[model samples]
Target: MLYREAGQFKTSYAKDQAVFPIIQDRWFIALVLVVAYGVVPLVANEYWLQAVLIPFLIFALAAIGLNLLTGYAGQLSLGTGAFMAVGAYATYKITTVFPEINILVVFVMSGFVAAGVGIVFGLPSLRIKGFYLAVATLAAQFFILWLFNKVGWFYNDNPSGTITAPPRTVFGIMVAGPRATAEVRYFISLTFLVIFALLAKNLVRGRIGRSWMAIRDMDVAAEIIGIRPLQTKLLAFAISSFYCGVAGALYVFAYLGSAETEAFDLLQVSFPVLFMIIIGGLGSILGSILGAAFIILMPIFLTNAPALFNLPMPTDLSKHIEEIILGGLIVFLLIVEPKGFARLWQIAKEKLRRWPFPY
Candidate 1:
């Protein structure tokens, strides 16, 4: 069989201890990266790139952050929307105040704001669990959004109840606001996604990851085993929010160029991202990306399907079909694989490993 690995052998410890022991898996990941960063831009039109791909990428990034907390660390959060807002508003202020800084710096610095807010909201997680902790996050959502709304200074006297991202240039190329090109933002978002994803992969595979997983599986057991519950939980919150912050910065500076109250609504946070991670898989980063893409593009396709096929779907019925598809996909995924897309991915990899050698 062309895909057989029966004869493969590892000699050195380092070679045997690698993340992907199989050569095919390593090549598969490399192929995916090449297609995502290289081949995609060549074929996709601006509408596809901006409307579908960008949203999918950024939201997947946010979902990955949330997955780290809710899925891995066992902290239930309903305030992901609030953390995203903190990032958006923080980016607005940083860029406007200096007006000379690199856009990359703003993306990174905005994480601090989200980190602070995440910590504050995370305080209640120590005392509460399940629905009570969820309620705590709800409080954070309302309070943080209110602070940004009523506080006129946060709006920068723009009189729009929003922040307009100024023109941003990366390495002397315009990459923000209306004048920015789709390709520029695509690359920027792609770069940040890659960097942070690598960091998260490392973090989750290391000691901190062990602690989070322990806490997730059972807090009491984790505590008895010497995992400090408070510190581990707080670190999850901080890192998770930091991911959201960078996503928020990109939302304004790269994609939208302006954001308002609706940008970080609970529905925006809980549904798109929360659902993405849940449907994709709780603990797998690849599942986050797959879920984000599936969630982001499905509705758009539903809306545009009629036009593409020359079929007449009433506007209202089209909307209903969109909802139906979403609901059905969730139900289908739940039924097909209770463990989620990650579990399916595992099954596929195993099948690849045992190709042409079925028991």
Candidate 2:
């Protein structure tokens, strides 16, 4: 009853087109923000912060990036891990070379580095698309990883070939490095996610976003209507890679603390993010968050389920079971709701608005 919009009347265009036009939705979002920003930090333990929340936020960002390209722009990319590597290595170099700069600035600059690389790779999108484009991007995945691994300069000629984030402070609060607390790191990642999410939301609602969608629906038709395919497609790639780059920076600095080329390997990084947007819903920001949480938490739940039942399950066996179950769930969701969880949520809301009616 409280969720009804019967009394809500939009008197202006701005109100009608507001992000959350319904009063209940705005309140719900506000409540969620309060809990995430205020309550979670105080109550969450090190295990929750380190093992779950931090990764979820980072992967959510990456998923959103992929969705922008594959979902909204209709440009298939299997090189997400490569772009993330660009960001991670770029951040490491920037912080080491220019120690006086702020860490936040380092992240943004790293994203631009990734954006430049994205534009180079995205040039191919002008000619080919669909499965062929995916193949081209897969090549990028291999090539970028090889470049980073074989190039000693990326790791500063370190024999270990590992890059570790140095301790950094923001407003006198330690947010990264060996001595940083989980709460601080969590807060930093959360802040970045919130800021970028809002930016993404606005971007998708603006003119550029509409151009991407037009190209996505049909390139020939969109071009006939004056939408430049090359410019729109490349813009999607740049923005997507930028988001992934920032995610890579956070994944290493805030979550991993130390990483190598293997940290952003194709299987571990790229495929999972692709799965996130597929299962969560393409072209939907909220779906990215939901998908990340589901992917990150599902394995943990599976590992603990046997323990709860007092069943003796070997680690290897449990892992296999988890993989099977995850695969099955993906198949089920694809078969039943190809648009994914976000679509289901939308349908539920529509039904709620017309409660007690057959329609």
Candidate 3:
């Protein structure tokens, strides 16, 4: 009943086309933002801030990026981790060389660097697609990691071959490095996710997003309709990589602090993000957030559930069981709800809208 929009009337195009046209949705989004910005920081413990929240936000951002490319643009990519590595390494280099610059600017610059790399790698999308395109991106995953591993210049010729986030301050508060508090890092990550998610949500409703979707649906038909495949596909890759690059920077500076190339390996970064969109729902921004939260929380729950239930499960067996369960859940969800959680949420909302009497 509360979901009713009976009195809400839009007399203007902007009002009618608003992201949350329904007053109820606008209020709900506002409440969510208030809780996220105002309440979470005040009550969350260090462990929650560091282990769960920060990583969840970062992964959500990455999933959004991948969702834009793979889900929206119909370009299959397996090089997500590689792009993240590009962002991390780019941030390291930028901060090292120009410590005087703002950290926010450095993050944006790192995203551009990753965008350039993404464009270069995304070139093959014009020539190939589907499994072959995925294979090409997979090659990128291996090649980029290999390049980072072998290049002494990337890690500042350090024998460790590891990239570490230099101490950085935002508005006089340390948000990166060993001295940074978990709360500050969480704030930074949360801010980035909020901004990016809003931008992505709006962007998907605009012309460029429509072009990408058209290409995704049918490239030949899109071309017949005046959508340039090259520009559209490359632009998708560039924007997607930019989002991913920022996510990678957050992963390092705001979350991990220090990491090696192995941290962004295909299995660790790539597959998980792909799984996120697949499980979250393709072509849906809300799905990206839900998917990230699901992926991030599931493992933690699996590990902790045994102790909570006082079950005597060995560590090795527990890990195996976790793997089996995750795999089974993915398959089951695919069978039951192919569009993932976002679609289910949409259906529930429709039901609510038609409540009290069956049509």
TM-score of 1: 0.96
TM-score of each: 0.96, 0.98, 0.99
Q: Rank the candidates by TM-score, best first.
A: 3, 2, 1
Name the candidate that leads on lDDT.
Answer: 3
What is the C-alpha lDDT profile of model 1 across 226-260, one tens digit per residue?
99999999999999999998998887777787888
Query: What would you estimate as the lDDT of candidate 1?
Result: 0.87
Task: Please tell me which model should have the higher lDDT, number 1 or number 3.
Answer: 3
lDDT of 3: 0.94
- Where does candidate 3 stray beyond 4 Å? none
TM-score preference between candidates 2 and 3, better one: 3
- lDDT measured at residue 192 in model 1 versus the true structure, 0 to 100: 85
Clashing pairs in 2: none
Mind sharing the TM-score for model 2?
0.98
Over the stretch 141-206, how does candidate 3's per-residue lDDT look in tens digits?
A: 999999999998998998888988888887898878899999888888888999999999999999
Best TM-score among the predictions, by candidate number: 3
